[model samples]
Target: MNTPIDLRSDTVTLPTRAMREAMYHAELGDDVYGEDPTVNALEAQAAAMLGHEAALFVVSGTMGNLVAILTHCGRGDEAIMGDECHTFHYEVGGAAALGGVPIRTVPNGHDGLPALADIEAAIRPDDIHDPPTRLLCLENTHNRCGGTAIGPEPFRAACDLAHRHGVAVHLDGARIFNAAIARGCPVRELVAPADTVMFCLSKGLGAPVGSLLAGPADFITRARKNRKMVGGAMRQVGVLAAAGLVALDQMVDRLAEDHEHAQLLAHGLAAIPGVHIDPSRVHTNIVIFEVTDPLAFLQRLQAEGVLGVYFGGQMVRLVTHYGITRADIEATLVTVRQALRAA
Candidate 1:
């Protein structure tokens, strides 16, 4: 039987051969004691690449974001974020549950940024009754916003406004590499303005698992302790860190291929009757389209050996990753058209 074309998410990507080899030969030591040479190297490389003073390797993007939030905010503090961001919509309220942090939501624009004015307004006043606003969270290549890439200018503007109000900005940059590729800019520039950033190596980068949180050395020092509090401290985890290193070295530039595949899928799907999407709005590897009967469409695609996930209501989300090729995109388009007709 042929392999199914899976477009559910980039997280489903398997590690590369190089990653496997590196993991096998990786130097191992107690990471909790800061003795894992490979983990230390990965952390150092990630910090240097993203232009930060230090970085902490975490188990996943969710944990990375949680640790960052815990480091930046105290009990009863508030964090402002876009309503459509992963931190607000997807994360299981770890900030509130574990850290006693309250979330303040602002509208996310189609371009995947909360308006500067809305963010400014969301900041809590210096009143005894209100929770002090401590952090502003942003998502690049925002998931719910159809993977729109937020460029550096708007990112810088938002960070500046938040900082002026004495609030630190934390970026949920799970797909920061994709955004960098889509914007044709350096990843350092895209991440420069934020006080903290959490990026997933398991996503588009195709590592088996791992995420990194980067920030000032002091912030990371505190985040490391927070990670331990959250039960995220690991031992001899350099095997996974080796894969992340390979991902960083080999997988960053090829994100352009996934972006192009998304364009192809978006344009083709838009041409089908009763399917709605704007190909021009597709900026990265994620493609979202509306169908008249999303359930039936998904069922048909499953039967046809094409896999994707529903994004609530009539929306379906497809993500192209490291192994998805032009052929896969072409086959997926054919399956989508057929499924729509059958539905």
Candidate 2:
């Protein structure tokens, strides 16, 4: 237990030395005035990489999501999303509280896309009693659905369906690079169909802070104002954006290692007597397994120096990120063996 294996989440990863160096050397400017050269450069890079007309740097994934929801929908309107989506389950209900947007959920399919029929059925008609379907949100490498990646065809179908209903699509692409790698695709290709997209620099890429929201220039322009209204405006923030630049340039391609580690963990955990998960569901960098007594299971893992998160009071999640290594995975397996034997 001398050294901890922090599999709690990818967001816990510390910046690499190269990222630290970039942060120290980043040129500073007034970001509120849009004069931060480094921030501007990073946003432009992200936008181009994602095939979007423009991008905005936000403080966190929650802020990025909240702003996007508010900006995309009218008050009393609705956005359709996965029932277990990060925006719905983890973002503290900011959309409902601040945006007055009703979140209509479509049950998540095993592959993480809402069933086409379910999505279509969830859309409201032009009736006065029902709220308008203002937007549709998609999560790539969906977190709660065992990190499943939505393939291009499925994504295109969903986008096409949403567009037919005159609903814009916003992607909460928190782990999109993982999805891109898992699918042997590029981030731009996965996000191409969505009208607006947000990806986290802090999650798998190991940036200390920030998420990028990209869309058409006009949408980004409105998002900027929405961010300001929510008190997300900041000054001299290029310091953090510098590390995000490092994440974009250097941290993306290495996500294959995390995915490999996650699959390894999933397969190993599946061998345990009490762990229940279809290892085939371990597609990306997240391993979610059901445990009979998650609190006891988590305590045993923590006592053994392997840490993770428990969801829905029963499912436990182990996420592999830039910080976890193959050797660490081996160590984790040994610890799991010991914990199970002792239990």
Q: List the residue pairs that clash in candidate 1.
A: none
Query: TM-score per candidate, in order?
Result: 0.99, 0.98
Residue 173 miss distance in model 2 (angstroms): 0.2
What shift in Å separates residue 36 of candidate 2 from its native position after superposition? 0.4
The lDDT for every candidate, in the order shown, is 0.94, 0.92
**Total clashing residue pairs per candidate?**
0, 0
Model 1: residues with Cα > 4 Å off, grouped in runs? none
lDDT of 2 by residue, 126-245 (tens): 998999999999999899898999888899999999999999999999899899999998778988999998999999999999999999999999999999999998999999999999
Candidate 2: deviation at residue 60, Å?
A: 0.5
Cα deviation of 12 in candidate 1 (Å)? 0.5
Which candidate achieves the best lDDT against the true structure? 1
